[model samples]
Target: MDRLILADTERREIKALLNVSMDIDLNETKDFELSVHRSAWDDTYQYGGYIFKPGTEIGGRIGRLNTDTALETVKVCGLTWRGMLNRKVIEPPAGQDYRRISGELHEVMKELIEPEFEGLFLVSEADTGVTVKNHKFERYTDLLSGIIKMLKSVKYKLRITYQEESQRAGYVLVEAVPIIDYSSQIELSSDSGLDFQLNDIRNGYNHMIVAGKGELAERNVFHLYAWPDGSIRKTPYYTGIDERVYVYENTSTETEEVEEKAREEFAELMNRQEFTMNTSDLQMEVGIGDILGGRDYLTGVYMAKPVENIIYTTDAYGTMNVEYQLEGED
Candidate 1:
C-alpha cells in the first residue's frame, strides 16, 4: 500500500496529517479519499498547509487526482488518477476541417497524445507498427473512436501505475498488433482460478464468405488443429450448433491470406469465446488488459483477459471486492 502523500499544484510540500485510502481498479473508474480532521484552526498543532477543497487537485509522489474533491463525513471523496480518458472533441482549422488522413498508430499517438499525458507508454513495435485505412476523422468524434474505427484487428488500453520512486503515477497506452498473440505478455493465474463459463462456442461454419465491393475471391474455410500436444484434433463444427456461413464486410479481398486472416480473427472474436469468472480474489496489480490463463476440471485450459470490472470497497482502505469479466477473445 502506498503511503497517502499529497502535494501542492507546484509539485512541492506533502500534506500534514490524515488517514487515507485508495483503489486502482482495472477497466473501470474508481475514487480514493483523504481523511482530514479539522477543528477551528488549532494553533496548538501545526496545520494549514494543503487545503482540501473543490478542485484542490493534489497528487505528486503519492498519486494524481481523477476528479475534483467532494466533502463527506470528515473525508474528501476525491477521485484518484487512474488514467481517466474522457471524450475529447477536437475541431480542425477551417478548410482542413475534415480530410481523409492515413497514418500508423504511433504517428497518431505521438501527435494527439504524448503532449498532455507525460507518463504515456506504448507497444509501438507491435505488428510492424500498425497501419490504418484512409478515413476521415470527423471533427466531433472522440480520439479513441476515430483510431479504432480506422484500424482493424487491434485493441488499445490505458494503464496507470503508482508503484515506483520516479513512477509515482505512470499512464501507458498499450496496443496489440494486427495478427498478434498476447499469450506471452499476459496469462491467467492458475492458482487464482475459480468458477467460470464459456459461451458462443462450437458454431458451425463450412465456409466463410468475406465480401466487399469489387472482389472475386472472398471465401475462406476453417482449419482444424491437430498436434501431439493434445489439442482439438478435429473440425470444431457441428450441424446442430446453428451458426454457419459467416459474411464479413469491409475486409473483402481476392487474396487468400487477407481473407483468411480477417475471417479467422473475426470468427474467434464473434464466436467460440467469452469467459466470465466469479472470484473473491483479484491481485492489486492485475490490470485491465493483463491476460490470465485458467483451467477448470470440466472445461480444460483457457486464456482470458478482463474487459469490465465492477468493484465495491467496504472500509476507506483495503482490497476491494471486484467482479470482472475475463473474456477469452481479445
Candidate 2:
C-alpha cells in the first residue's frame, strides 16, 4: 500500500472544503431565546493583632466593607422568536459571561442555524430482466446533484485504485494495484431546488448510486452504504460486481457465457466500469451528549490501505505492512 502524506495547510484546506460541502444554508424563519441571571454578597474574617496581653496573645475582629465585591448569578430561559432567515451565532469568548438578553439572542441564533446532509436513495434487488434506468441522464449538473445527494447521505470517503494490465504470450491476466484514497465529504445546498430530508436517518437504511469514469469500465453498479455517525471506516464495502462475484440464478452454462460476453462488451463501451459497495457499520458513532459540556471531545475518522500483495514470476507471494505516526507542531 502506498501512503499519501498531506501537509498541515493542505489538511486545513481540505477540512474547510469538507465543512462547506456538508453545511446547508437555510432561510426558514425560526429562533429561540436564552435568559441569564446573576447575584452578589459579602463575607468577613478575623485576624491576629500586633498587641500582646500580659498573659496571652491578642486577636482582633475586623469590620471592613468588601468594596468592589459583587455577587454573580446566571440562569438561562429559552424563548421562541421569529426571523426571515437562519443565522449563526458568534459566541462570546470563554471567560466572558452572557447577559440575560444576549443569552436569549444566542439561543435564537443556535436554533436558526440548520443541520446538514438531507438526501435519500432507495434501492432493492430486481429480477435479471428488469430494465435499469439512469435517473439524471445527460445533464452533468443534474448528475452532479444526484451524485452529491447520494454521497452526502452515505458519507462516503472516496478511494481511487488504479492498475495497469498487460497481455503476454496469448495468456490474459490482469494485475491490480492499490492507489490513493481520496478523502472528501458531500454537501447539499438548500437553494438547489432539490427536495430532501433527514427523515431517512431515523428510518434505518438507504441506498445510492456510484458512477465511474475512465479505466473503470469493468465495475458499474449502485452501491448503498450507510454511516449513521458518518464513520467512513465502518462504511459498507461493495465493488458493485454482483454478477462477477456471484452465481446467477437459474442460468445455464450457455446463458453464463452470454452474460460474460455482454459484460465484456459493456466494459469496452463504457471505457471504465463503475462499481459500488455498501456497509451497515458506517453509521455507528458517539452521541451528541457524549461530547457536549465536556472538557475535551476527541473524535477521529480512520482508514486503512493494503500496502502489498505481490506475486512474483517464481510463484512467490509476499505482503508488506506500514504504520502511521503523527509529529507535534513545530
Candidate 3:
C-alpha cells in the first residue's frame, strides 16, 4: 500500500496514517477519511494539517476530526486542494474596479492566481490550447470553482501537481490540460470479464428556451435546438420526435451572449451515454477527465465517455480498490 503521511502546515513530516480512503471527483473537491485508535490521537493531528500520499501527487488538508469514545477510534476527515484553494474567493485586486480579467487560460492563471498563492503554489507553463475572452469573475466566487467552470467551458480540466520531497515540497503546481482521450487506446469489454452499468439518455431534452435580462416585453429570449447532425439551430428542427424543452435563464443582456449561453445550455442537455464501473480487480489505467471506451456485446452497446469521478480506497492490508463514474457523450 502507498504510504499516507500526515504533515504539518509547513509540510514537515509528522507520521504515517492507517486505513485512509479518498473519494475524488472532477466536478467537486476531493474528500478523505482516516481512522486511528483513540490512543493515537494527539495535538499534532489537528485540523488544517496536510495529508500526503507519497509517490503520487495526492494531497489533502485536514478539515475535521471526530472521536468515538465507545469505539475508541478517532476519525479524521480531510479536503483536497490544501483546504483553502477550494474555499478562498477570488477577490478583486486592490485599486481594480472588478475581478474581470480575460485572456488565454495560462495568462489568466499567471495574472490572477500566481500572486495569490505566491511561493506556496506555482502555475505551470503548459498551454491547454484554450483561450477565454472577456471572462468575468464574480464576487465571492471560489478560486478553484471558477477555474474549473472556465476549463469545462473550453473542454479542458485543471491538473494540480503536488510536490512531496523537493525544494518545492508541500507546494502544488497548477496547469490546464486537455482531457486525456483513451478511446482509441483502451477499451473495456465483456470479453474481458469486466462488469459495468450503461446509461443512455434516450428521452432527454432536445430544445431550449433561454430568457435573458429584461422584463416582459423588453426581455431578450433565444431558442436553440440540438440537431441530429450535432449542430445547434435557432429555427425549428428535429420534428416527428417528441420535443423536450429546457428553459434556461441568464443574467446577460447582450444578444450574442445570451444566444451563446443558450446554445451551451442546450448542448449540455443533449442525449449522452453514461457508464459506471468498479475497476478494483481490473486496475484500469484511467483517471478523472479521461475518456474511456466500453463495449457490452450482449446489448451491442458501445460508448466512449469521460470519467467524471473516482472512488479509491486502501484497506489495512494494503489492498487498493477503485471505481469510476463516466459521463459525457463526446
Cα lDDT, all candidates? 0.42, 0.20, 0.70
lDDT (10s digit) by residue, model 3, range 1-330? 577788887778888766544443323446677666676567888677877766454667778988777886777777765345676788867886447766789878877677776565677777656789877765557887777777777777777766666553566677788878887877888666777778767676878888888889898877788777667877767666578888889875355457755776776678766777645556656656777778887888887777766666666555666666666422
RMSD to the native, candidate 3? Answer: 4.0
Question: What would the per-residue lDDT of candidate 2 be over residues 139-234, giving only the tens digit for each residue?
Answer: 122222232222222232111111111331111111111222221232222232222221111332222333332234553433334333432222
Q: Write the per-residue lDDT of candidate 1 for residues 1-330, one digit (tens) a residue.
A: 223444443323344434443333332344444443343122222222122211211221223223223543244443333323333443455787563555676666455544544443333434446555565665556554454444433554433333223535322334433422344554444455555555535443443444544536533433443222323323444344453555555444434345434555454634345666654565543444445445554556464544444344334443335555554423
Query: Model 1 reaches what TM-score against the true structure?
Result: 0.48
Q: Rank the candidates by TM-score, best first.
A: 3, 1, 2
- Badly placed stretches (over 4 Å) of model 1 are 16-18, 23-27, 30-72, 78-84, 90-107, 114-139, 144-156, 161-193, 200-272, 279-285, 301-303, 307-330
Candidate 2 residue runs with Cα over 4 Å from true position: 1-139, 142-148, 151-159, 168-330
Looking at candidate 3, the ten consecutive residues that score lowest on lDDT are 20-29
How many clashes show up per model?
5, 30, 0
